[model samples]
Target: MTNSTWLKSADNRVKLLIFAFTILLLPFVALSFFTFPTTDDYCHTLTVNDMGYWAYQKHYWLTWSGRYIGTLISATQPLTYGSYFGYKVAPAILLLIYVHAFITFAKALSANKLPTWQTALLAFLMLFVFIAEMPSVAGYIYWYTGYYYTVADISTLYLLAYFFRHYPAITAQNIIVLSLGLILLIGMNEYTLVWLVILCGSLFFFKSIIDKKLHFKFLVLSLVALVFGVLSVTAPGNAARAESGLYPTPLKYNLLFSLKSSFTWEFHNLSKMAPALCVLTLVLIPIACILYTSRKPGEFGFFFVHPAFSLLVFAIALYLSYFPSYWSIAEPPNLRGQCVINFWTLIGWTFNVFVIIFWLLEKERIRPILSLGVLSWVVAFYFFSLYLSNFNYRSAWSDLLTGRAARYNKEMIARTELVLSTKEQQVTVPKLKNMPYTILNVTPDWDPAWASVEVNNGCAEWYFKKKFFYK
Candidate 1:
């Protein structure tokens, strides 16, 4: 190829990267625009309405099931939601992570020293894969409830890539950064930190296996991961026992069900074909390289396939972690099944993301059709996931929201100038009673048996109690 031709190809690759970045942001705007104000959103709105900016700080008082960071944000910031916005720091964090993932994927493609066309293909595929199977976007981005998971997962991936790229230069200073990253992951949710540990271990294992000289580093990584994993899983220092009225055990059990639930959801997506294509690319690429090098035996060896092999190793690690049905030993499923599946899922997702890149970066004649097909499948999968999410919300919405009559009270509070003098009122509507949420105690009556109360602003306040509020 001539110098000018090479220059044009490089320019095209750069343009393609820019295009991918633009595409990534479009979904964020699109999803945020259409979602209705669900109950959790409304409840958050009510909190803002009642406490004003202080509601943000009060979020810190609320313990996150997995991570403590949200509480930290709420603690530091007087959580503010006006007529137009609720606490959006979580979503903003997600945006940053997605952007970072795209950039990293693109740079890796560019650096792999592949042909120009191959580079463009790789970049496009990465973004495509991310949107397809990552139900995080559908669940959290749409409802704003699951955004933290997206933020934490993408952030952990980005951080892992950064650490890996600079492994030799990692310093004591980097340890602090890694610590903060762990805290943020845990804050996003405990599962995230657990996943982070698994991923670090996976990466270390990959290096040791692939490099032929990194056994010590791999051992060290495994130990660090083991220690971090233990600390993360056990660190819920102040968890309270569930009240008799709640079914916490069933919910914990549901985490086990995640093995089935996640795979079922994933397989249902049309875009899952992308992973199959990735496996094909991984297989074909080595075959092609073998043929290319067979023409000149001195130019290459089986090790020319190291990147592909590395990918396979990583892919296996991911499969074991995320693909729920892969763990056959656990009967009917156990916490062991869900114990740290997110790690594998996230890593598996990352591998898929890169496979999409490889598809795009291949210099074959069918590139355009492959790219379009992959992109179309991903978008279709995203919409399907959204449809399923809405279906779930619809199924539960009436029971969880409309049945409560809490929206009416929330709307009333929205219009009132009532200084929430005291968070001192909580009403427990009888379970299975089918009664509308009582507007009782707007006039300040406290019957301890009939209510639970805390003093927030000053005036006695009453609210219904539930396992989870609507969002």
Candidate 2:
């Protein structure tokens, strides 16, 4: 086939893939409609309402977290204004934004050589892998309070896209835009701060070496990001929050624990088949196709680094994702934190695979091995495996099929109605009979009697203006 004809065929195939993935994702979006607020959602809404927006931001900065941008977003959750519909649709909205950012990054990486439809398919695949294999879809996707991490992840993608699209010729405009993006990213979450600094620092170091001259604009950008990162890590709320945790370890112990725990988590993800399948089918295949079709191999100068060095850089990035949680709290990150780690893992793995492929393409013997038939088989197997074992998709479908999500929504609504209508100062409600596996329910329950008295009562009392307990 001619090159243009092949390109047309490939674009058509990518469009089909995007459509299929979108259909598969619809159930997860549907489940979001049944989502209800829980745990920190209530506390944050109450605090924001009582304290006002600016005061709540100050309170969070001083006592809870230094995540200024994150806290700022959390304080304005739909629940704070009693918009249940807004709460229900927030995840869908965030998911759409995430997809857009991913597509932008993917297009930039491809240098716009691929069609928009092709980049979109790449985004869909990445999203599917993330939702399916991430440790906590509920915490990261459905929970409104956890959205700071989501927004941070999205911002990172956009910043990286901008960097990729405009590197080697950094303009004043680029510096200003990057500076603003870095400030927002660093303030959203410490994980993104550490990840971005390491990534940009490494790139700046390598690019300077390659060009045999210092890039002054990037140097300024890096310094700006570093200053913001320091501000975030040193926030007074970090210390206060650490002190308030139930178990506080010494700094030395926390560092050691973080090293061990981070390595263990990284090793676990590396060994998983699902992620490997995703790397091969979603990431490697498209990259190989783009490289093979390109007229000049030298256009990808960035991928010319030694594969071992690239792997080491990616390893450090992945490890640091786990470090902040352990260093601060002396425990593994919560489910929300795992989402960031998983994202880093996927990105690192994909990049490493790309480096290897780029290196292999230089060898005449290996060029023939990357055939269309082999890629087709890989794609077929990926879909088959995803259908059989993708945990997120299966869990979401189970919640919908068994009516668990509906029942959970019904129970939460009934409880809210009781809290609002009751004249008594204290109220007792029944424990939730159905909890969807696809949603995280951290609210206190009767089974754990203390949780009912402690967490459930406090937040419910403040938010509903009535004491709440579970029977």
- Measured by TM-score, the strongest candidate is 2
Residue lDDT tens for model 1, 1-471: 584465356676577556655654543542332223322334444455566655544443343232355433332221223332333234444555565674564444233345544544444444444444343333444334344555555676566655644454556666666656665665555445445566567656666666676755445555665665564344443232122222234434345565665455434442444553454344334333323433333222222323455466544444334432322222222222232333345345445444444443443423322233345446446544543454222322332345333443244344232323323343322212232211112213432112232322222122232221111
Error of 1 at 64 (Å): 5.5
In the order shown, the candidates' Cα RMSDs to the true structure are 10.9, 3.6
User: Can you tell me which runs of candidate 2 are displaced by over 4 Å?
Assistant: 1-15, 115-117, 248-252, 273-286, 292-298, 362-365, 368-370, 442-457
Per-model TM against the reference:
0.52, 0.89
Question: Each model's C-alpha lDDT?
Answer: 0.42, 0.74
lDDT, residue 191, candidate 2: 78
| Local accuracy of candidate 2 as per-residue lDDT tens digits, 1-471 | 584465467667676766776777677788889998776677888888888999999998998788989898888778877788876898888877887888888887777876666667666766767777777788788888888888888888888788777764669998899989988988988778888788768777876887899978878777887888888888889888788745546752466778888788767766774444454554465455566558264565666677877888888887777777776676677777778877877777766666777776655435523345446657757666876677777888899889989998898898888877899988887887887877764444432211222344566566777766676
- Each candidate's number of clashing pairs is 22, 0
Query: Highest lDDT among the candidates is held by which one?
Result: 2
